[model samples]
Target: MMHDIPDSGDQPHLPTTYASVAVIGAGSWGTAVAATFALAGVDTRLWGRDKDVCDGINRDGMNARYLPDVPLPKGLRAFDDMAAALSGVDAVAIVVPSRSIRAVARQVAQHAPAGADIAVLAKGIETETGLLMTQVAEEELEGHVVGCISGPTFASETALGYPTAATVAFPFSYADRLKPEASPAARMAISLSTETFRAYVSDDVVGVEIGGAVKNVIAIACGMMTGAGFAENTRAALITRGVDEMKALAEALGGRRETVTGLSGMGDLTLTCSSTTSRNMSLGLQLGQRIPRAECFDGRPVVVEGEMNARSVTDLARRLGVAMPICEAVRAILHDEADLGQTFAALWARPIEAEPNAMDLSFAHPASDKAIQKLAERIA
Candidate 1:
């Protein structure tokens, strides 16, 4: 019963003459996305702010620092010159870390070709404005089509061409008018869709963004449970409770609750929580082991988005008068405001309530037949 914008099979192929794509940020996820586009026959250019990293990718076609042992496609190009990379590209994918999203967007806005549709791959709430990625793009890259791609994708696995699924979110009105002739940039959009990877479209931009941002924090909590030697029952409880926190936050931020239940929400939370490959979850494991955050994060250039998102999400929940005990506890642990034992005790000591209470009922009721019928009508 999930509402999705129909995929227009008419997405234009990359121009044989000179279709260009520039992917900002050459981190693991960025590199993976760039590789995917290149394999799909786009004239792909990957931009890394680090000259050495760019040189490595250009010379060896491998990003050893971030994604070691994975050879990039021959068609993938690397560039350190932001201006050269951005010049004349049909579309650009902004894949920088969450905390640096604004600064990177400004740089792209200044350099990327006019009228380019920016597909943002960065996922995190801006700590300063609490704006979702698309909002940040709208503020910085005015007049450009903004889209978001998010899900429970692991960069390493994605780079290796593992089958993966993700959601692409934009306005439904824009999706309705999507034709091969819409923009020269449309060529880049075609390469974005591929066989091994699938992208479902949605108009619920905020919902998708929230799902991508909030799930990482929940992943951290699940990791804590695992590191603490908790069993499957505990993990299941954490996942369920985590979804509640995510739905509450998503709803308060004007996102559809159903979006959180889809791939971006429940799907992402499950994947991140279950995998040690997740940076946020690994960070939590390290914290649970009593390792200092600085030591655990030492020499790690990649962003553990949940660490930054925890603060912003907690702050937003507080401002909106929403209950997010898990997020609040995470914030305390991250900021050293409380010890893990104290936080764990606080969580355990929380007031007992019915199995389904308050916001919990919102999720439970949706699976009922009556609710499904109502949702079907809404989507139809």
Candidate 2:
């Protein structure tokens, strides 16, 4: 929680060969990336909220609370002092929860070097402003370049040195700063990638950010289906349609359509929806078992980013005039006290249209559209 920067003499020495990187937030994802940076030979320091997690990481080389039994890279260090963590780093990775991103960005703005590149690992739209993580960073870290890294990464798997791939989208507005001679983005890409973790670079920040945010909500819906004993057909339908919902929102927000089908979108959606280790999906499982939302989170400290973003993302889609039925259904369930039956009922009542860019129903028999409309009306 160190807010202010000290005198210039207090600056930490950064290695020239390996970029100096500070990963804010010692949660699962943050710790995993810190370990990856260390493995990549970067000077990495993980900033944690509590002292015990930091103490354990520093003393035992294990994030006992987040990634127990997994030995971290020897070079990775943890600190409770935020200023000490951020000082003189070439890149800062904001891996804190979505809600905390803005505040952490402000803190980073104060302490991190002005030329340092930032990579946000937290996924989700801000509930208050309905802004994506990158947008939120822009607000608090004005004059600083912000980017995002997202994909099908489960923190535990990555911490265990399992093979993983992610996409990093640096802002194009920083083109001058990203020149081959002064390429912080290239350095960031190099620092993030390891033998086991591959990082791909992209320029479509909106597409990458939206894909990661929306998939979590879809995963929650998928988890509910699994818990309710729904067949694989239901799961498949959700996953397929969920990508469309994601693409719709991303396209509406000035992002490339193809980006949604890439690593940050389809890849992430598939991994999250199918895994019980996902915190968002696990929350959905509890709800699917008929547990009340309040009861499910009674004393748990885990931040379910999907639950936090469900309504906000739905609102964003609404403002953008994009239809996202899957996200809408998730919002209803999480914020409206809606049951599974009600969610399905609402989904069934929606107008049936041909999948986006599929066979043109207008050229096909008019009867086909009429029949689909009739079925939708009947369901309604």
lDDT of 1 by residue, 1-380 (tens): 23322344743442232267899999889999998888777789999988999899988989988888999999888899999999898788899888788888998999988877788888888888878888898899998888788887898888898998787776544434453233322333455656787666666778888889888888887777576656688679878988888887888888888899998888899999888889888988777766777788664665688989899888888888988888787888887567676676556556555655554432233234544354333322
CA lDDT, candidate 2, residue 27: 81
- Candidate 2 lDDT over residue span 1-380, tens digit each: 11122223763532123468899989888899899899988899999889999999989999999888989998888999989998888788899889888998988888888777788988999988899998999888877788999999999899898999998787654443334223444456667778898877677889999999999999999887676666689788999999999988998899987999999999999999887788888888777767767677665766798988898899999998887888888888788876675575556455547765465432334355455465334323
Candidate 2: list runs displaced more than 4 Å. Answer: 1-18, 173-182, 297-301, 357-380
Q: Where does candidate 1 stray beyond 4 Å?
A: 1-18, 174-189, 297-302, 354-380
Error of 1 at 119 (Å): 1.6
Flag clash pairs in model 2. none
Best by TM-score: 2
The alpha-carbon deviation from the true structure for residue 261 of candidate 1, after best TM-score superposition, in angstroms, is: 1.6
> Which pairs clash (backbone N, Cα, C closer than 3 Å) in model 1?
none
Q: How many residue pairs clash in each candidate?
A: 0, 0
